[model samples]
Target: MIYAVGDIHGYADQLDRALALIEADGGPDAEIVFLGDFVDRGPDSKGVLDRLVRGQAESRNWRFVLGNHDRMFLRFVTEGQQHDDRIKSGLSWMNPRLGGTTTLRSYGVGGPDSPAFQPPRGKVVETLVSWWTNQGNLSDQEVIIAAREAVPDAHLNFLATLPLWHETDDLLFVHAGIRPGIPLEEQEEDDLIWIRDGWLEDDRDHGKLVVHGHTALDTPEHHGNRVNLDGGAGYGNRLVPAAFDAGEVFTLWPEGRRPLVPA
Candidate 1:
């Protein structure tokens, strides 16, 4: 069986529980695929990256799919800037909602979480200059230098190596759902990692069961055509791991596997 974990989002403790459940169901040699967004939101992005990098060193059978947040993080750490418009408008990754601040905190660089760095919500902008003035400011250079020193090169390499999607005969795993009707190989990178509309609502088949985790839901959803495993672990909900074999999906529980039927 192939085991797949949803977005971890820096919650190393939840990841531990999910891994324990996967081990209980499939043992140590199980092929585990991680749908990404491994960093941000919670307390221990550093820890989560450490474990994944170590696992790769051990030559474990694991696969990682890149998520949008991971891309933003890589950009910030390597280039000292983020490409997202929110960064300029002030709701940066360090914004509590995005959790980049928490990730930086895990690396021992403090102060990103201070209220002074977060943009005030609901504030009206009179003009473009005022809008610029209202923007939350955080120093990317300070965080980048400290992060470069504290975060192991191996971890950054691991994130760099993640693919947009991993496919098997019966299942296709990705960070977010694929664009409907587009060939998997031809799909755009942004759509693969950041898409929500068009992909999530369409029930049409995309040649294989698309298993993904970008849009967090209250529970795992099986729509007969796809499976969503992102159970909001990034938002403090449970990180439910899953197992797949012969085109069937099962949620891994401590007792064993439970068949996940379409909701």
Candidate 2:
């Protein structure tokens, strides 16, 4: 059996439980695929990622697809000051409003920054950092610089290596939905990781059954052509992990399985 888990969003406890549920449901040999956003907006982004890094080292069957937040996190850490608005944004990843503060806290970074500290509104991350410093929020600015150092080397490498999507004979697993009508192989990376635009509205088949997260729902949604398994875990609720037997879907747990539509 193949199992694909939805956005984990840094809740290590839920992640552990979800893994246990998968193990109980499919035993040791099941192929596990994780759709990302594995960091930000939760208590333990580092803890959640550390577990995945270890899982990858131990199991060749484990696969991961990067999410938008994960992309932002990577840019914040690795890309440094180089900013193109096309690929980078204005320190949104470091702002608490976008859940970056919670993610940084997981790594033992980001102290009590000034409540009033706001970077100059700009399109470049370099400008944001510079503005923070200019505003005399020196402590917050220094923490931003050092937080990248706080991330473990293994964790950084793991995040850097995550794929945009994973595909099987009949299913395309991605962090977010693919753009409708576009050839799957030719779809833009941004659309795969961040799209909600017309992709969510159009019901036209995109060749393969797209299984995804990013757009959260109260429950796993079966929209015929797609399955949305993001249970809003980042917003603090159950982490919805799912299993697919051939192409049928199920919500999995230790006690039992709830067959999701057409199963």
Candidate 3:
């Protein structure tokens, strides 16, 4: 059986709970797919990344699709700038408004009084160092430095190799929803990463169940033959995970938030 989940958005605790439920229902034999947005807008983005990286390394059946946030992470790593021309042109002020600013701050990237003053490149290195030393579990400082220096090329290669989309027998996964009118081959990455209302409203078939996360819906809303599992997890909203074959759904809310029915 296959189990698909939506945007984790750095909620490692919630993710753990959801995965526990999945395991209780079915063991490691079950195939699991995550719809991306694995980082940002939470206190533990580093932890989330570590978990996913470990999972991918160890598991053959697990799949992870690229999200807009993940793309931003790559851009930040390569371009050394938070705002990409393509992203900004596509949606003005959308990236920064959606807790991107906060996420950058968490990485020690942008602030008025930040030490990243003269050379922004220094800031990138500092951010990486901070993430490595503080967030990573390297026992020795020298080991961490050696690891960073040795794996520079590997890191870039891995980020660049992330798949923008993934298709399976039961579901089609993307960061955001796809364009309704255009063929999948002709669809733009921006639309797949940023579209909301139109794709959700259109009823056209996309050959398989299009499971996506990007639109921060209040609930696990379903429309246009697609399942939107974003659930606004990063914006103090509930973390929702939808399982495909088992027909199960799990919602992990903040301390006082109201709960949704399981499955």
Candidate 4:
């Protein structure tokens, strides 16, 4: 059986749990595909990248697809550039809800006493929001420089080399759902990592069962045409790992395996 894991979003503890469950279900050498978003949001993006990079180095039976957040992190550290207008104009990636600041802290970019590290509450929230109103500005240049210095070359290389999708005979794995009616090979990168509206709502088949995790759900959802395992790990929810065989999908939980029938 092949295993597919959802977006990890920097929660190393939860990631470890998901890995352990995958190992138990299919041994250490199980063929596994990771739906990305390996960085940002949670406290240990650095830690998550550390483990993922080490696993790749050790020749673990694993593959990864890039997610939007992962791309944002890479762009910020590599070029001090930010994607998505919402982030560029708002609190940027460091917005409390998006949690880029937490990832920066994991890399030692900001200390506990730095204003960037202050909890977003009351006046602090107002101050931070006002301060970060325009990202990619001189005000945050130091943080960007520190992040670029703190992040390792190896991790950056790994992120740079990640593929947008992985596929087998019967299943296709990607960070986000593909654009329906478009050939898999022809799908755009943005649709692969950032799409939701048209792709998520469309029920049309796309030749293979698409396994993805961009949109967080409280539980894994089986929509006949695809399986979503995101489970909101970036939002303090579970990082569910799924095992697929013979067109059947089962979530690998600590307690045991649970079948996810198509909705």
> Which candidate wins on TM-score?
4
What would the per-residue lDDT of candidate 1 be over residues 1-263, giving only the tens digit for each residue? 69999999999999899989988888888999999999998899999998888888899999999998898788778776534542334455555567766887788766533533423357421111111111234344545566677777787888888899998888899998888988888998888898888988898877888899989998898998899999988887988999997767899877788899887
The C-alpha local distance difference test score for the whole of candidate 2 amounts to 0.78
Q: What is the lDDT of residue 6 in candidate 1?
A: 91
lDDT of 4 by residue, 4-95 (tens): 98999999999999999998988989999989999887889999999999999999999999998998888888987644543333445666
Please provide, for model 3 over 111-208, each residue's C-alpha lDDT reduced to its tens digit, 9 standing for 90 to 100: 42212112245332112222222333332233233333432454345456777678877568888889886777888878877777677777877787
TM-score of 4: 0.88
RMSD of every prediction:
4.8, 3.7, 7.6, 5.2
**Comparing 1 and 2 by TM-score, which wins?**
1
Query: Which candidate leads the pack in lDDT?
Result: 4
TM-scores, all candidates, are 0.88, 0.87, 0.70, 0.88
Clashing pairs in 1: none
* Whole-model lDDT, model 3: 0.60
- Model 3 alpha-carbon drift over 4 Å, by segment: 85-96, 100-158, 246-263
For all candidates in order, the CA lDDT equals 0.80, 0.78, 0.60, 0.83
**Residue pair clashes in candidate 3:** none
Q: Give the TM-score of candidate 1.
A: 0.88
- Deviating ranges (above 4 Å) for candidate 4: 85-91, 112-138
